[model samples]
Target: MRKILNTAHIYMIIGVVSGLYSRELTKAEDFTGDTQLDVVHTHVLALGMLFFLIVLVLEKQFTLTSSALFGWFFWIYNIGLAVTVGMMTLHGTLTVLGHSSGEAIAMVAGLGHILLTAGLILLFVTLGKRLQPAPAPGSDAAPDPDPAAPLPAPAP
Candidate 1:
């Protein structure tokens, strides 16, 4: 939970900074009126802030920490998001500076998406397992359901 909140905070800060950066670009001589800055703001806000915020809420309800894959999901998802945004930022900044972006940037972006996809797949699997019904009150065939939504005992 702390990690989730911290991640959310990080994204929020980045979003705000990007917004400021966008404004700064407007006054610069190199401003070509491209949407890069706008993209930067949206990227940070949509993925960085909003994405984490939603995850934080889901964490409360689903308690992601219980899953073995929680750590993997958290790290992979965040790393992917960071990489994707980083590449986007790099390309966007270059474009804003009137520099030509090339194939290398696109390659990195593809890698970032791969990481992001892997993270999301892990998340989906974890959520599916978590939402399954718990063992019938200690039948021992299964473990437990989310404490917040405990399954009832076997039909009496």
Candidate 2:
């Protein structure tokens, strides 16, 4: 799960950075309000993704007593992200297909980034639930070790 999350984090970072740089280059060639807004939105979404990735990494490493609570929160956050991205993708598709009348091709490309973000969110949530911490070794409510018993005692 950690590996998957790390990979997603790297992918998102690269994608957003590439997008921002590309938009800036485009603006330099011909400044436009739409390009400026695209740059802002990319940076904002990248920041949010970074925060979520950090939380996921921390949860992967730390075993809190209320780990399940954190897990649920993360799960809900992911679901929300999925919904947001899914809507954006739907809107973009409609616009691209000419079923809708007012949005641009660049906006549709931004929706692609949202789709990737949603997929990564769902992947992390599912893996995080499955990879929950196991009980610490030797911490089960078993009978105390018998000093009289030799090492490698028989299982109960």
Candidate 3:
């Protein structure tokens, strides 16, 4: 899981950086006004995802609860990244296709991005709930007795 999350983090960072650089070039060439904003949004979303990855990696407690929470958060972050990229692609496609009928496609894509962001936030909260340390075995609050505890004396 750690390996998967780290790989995802690296890929997301690379994608964001590339997108931003491309946007800068496009702006220099006087590309559409919305392109720049889309690039910026992608970068911001990537940063948020990276933060969650960091938290997952650094967290000390590894258990079923933590695993489930991490899985949920990981899903959200990936989904958000997907939505962000999808929106940018949709915007570009609409521009290229020369569709000016309702702008509904762009609006729907934007809505998807918003939903993804909300999901990521919810995941963060759920992760908090799972961050607690597991209780020690044998007692909820007390440490287990040493296995080397002296055996009872034999009856006379």
lDDT of each: 0.81, 0.51, 0.58
Cα RMSD for predicted model 3: 8.3
Off by over 4 Å in 2: 1-4, 7-48, 56-66, 101-156
Alpha-carbon TM-score of each model against the true structure: 0.80, 0.37, 0.52
For model 2, name the residue pairs that clash: none
Ranking by TM-score: 1, 3, 2
Best by TM-score: 1
Candidate 2 per-residue lDDT over residues 46-122, each given as its tens digit = 54466556655654554321345545445444554444444444443343334552455446545555654664565
lDDT of 3 at 19: 68
Report each candidate's C-alpha RMSD, comma-separated, in the order given. 5.2, 10.8, 8.3
Candidate 2, TM-score vs. the true structure? Answer: 0.37
Output candidate 1 Cα RMSD: 5.2
Assess the local accuracy of residue 87 in candidate 3 as a C-alpha lDDT between 0 and 100.
Answer: 61
Clashing pairs in 3: none
lDDT of 3 by residue, 2-36 (tens): 65556556766756775665566556666664543
